[model samples]
Target: TEGLVMAKNSSAADQLELIALAVRGNVSLALAARAVRSAVEAGEYEAIARALADQAGRNDPLQPRDRALAATVAAELSRLGSKAAPLWQVAREAWELERSAWWLAYALFREAEALLSAAGKRDAARDVLVRARSIARLLEAAPLLAEIDALAGRGRVDLGSPSPQLLDPVPDRKLPISDREMEVLVLIAKGLTNKEIASELFISERTAAHHVGHIFDKLGVSNRVEAASVAHQAGVLVEDT
Candidate 1:
């Protein structure tokens, strides 16, 4: 009976409301999945790719290349599997992708590395590591590089050992404080009570106490004296030797 209803009552707005309800409830993800499959069947490659990538990010249903382009990619990946050698060119291609999108590179590297390592090809695995490190250097991503190094070595080598390549430059901070917060912290470092700090900053004593508490938290210290020492170390305050 409802199938005979006119298009006016079942407007786009009504369709949208139904979509919202389905999404809010996750009532039928299989139906949603079928919709995506239908879209892919309809030659909506761009939309399918975006949606597949999003699902990949969310760890949802794994992509089995339901689209032509993705199927070609899967075939290419299969052909490029580490059956022969390290293939530096392939490694470099993976590195370039890694530089552009770390997660994407991560996916490719994980697959390639698994194949190489499983075959007991340590040299090829090390080559993959070198390319990954090069990409990491380009991106200035220390933590990610460290993680890759750790996984590449498979605990055979200690990652914490200091090496020239591991040294990422530290950034300089001027006083390590914002001007507004520094104004209040300096008064505290001068041995002023909270009430006195309030009088100096023209704020309430309660507000002054709150600021001092925040200062302690930021400095990672429990008391005023340690906070002062941190401030001096941070160059927020100069102390004569």
Candidate 2:
């Protein structure tokens, strides 16, 4: 898969190509954006951001989906480059132009780390994040929903409606870690952040962070990168847990 390939270290040119695809409104804009962010130099991001803004400007009145993608591309590009604050504002207007669920949620779902890491931009992140999460709910994209919830970190976000059937059954077992905690650990070992783990488990970010702290205490590892290596070495995240 292109996503799996992007997950591994790839050349800057390959990542830039992905960015180009995303800028041109390709379906995997989130994955491509992430690949570019991870692989390309910071200086290159501005050029890509400009390309996204330009692509977003070419709205096709006949294709609502393409119009939606234009907005999504504008929104997705906000996560990159030093000019994010202004791009984020542009993205917000684009978001307001459409109300229904679309690929924008997919793009915003990938914005978790970047948005949350932006410090002073929490206000900006929140305004757009609310729309993104709502759209995710309408789309019934559970993983995307969870990612939004966990990253929101407020723990009180109204998830719109419950869809218990869509979620994996909460496993039950006896071990140093609860089944839920174990599940979090497995996701962690799989390179999911606490936010992504929370999304995957349909839990709160605060809860996810707490579970991770406990997992670290139990496993005697200090950080998630270390936790992944240690868990693999000890077979702690084995299947059929």
Q: Which candidate is the best by lDDT?
A: 2
Model 1 TM-score, 2 decimals = 0.28
Q: How many clashes show up per model?
A: 0, 1
lDDT of 2 at 6: 65
Per-residue alpha-carbon lDDT of candidate 1 for residues 164-193, written as tens digits (9 for 90 to 100): 322112246454545546766766777889
Give the per-residue Cα lDDT of candidate 1 at 6.
32
lDDT of each: 0.50, 0.59
Q: Point out where model 1 deviates above 4 Å.
A: 1-101, 155-241
- Report the CA-based lDDT of candidate 1 relative to the real structure: 0.50
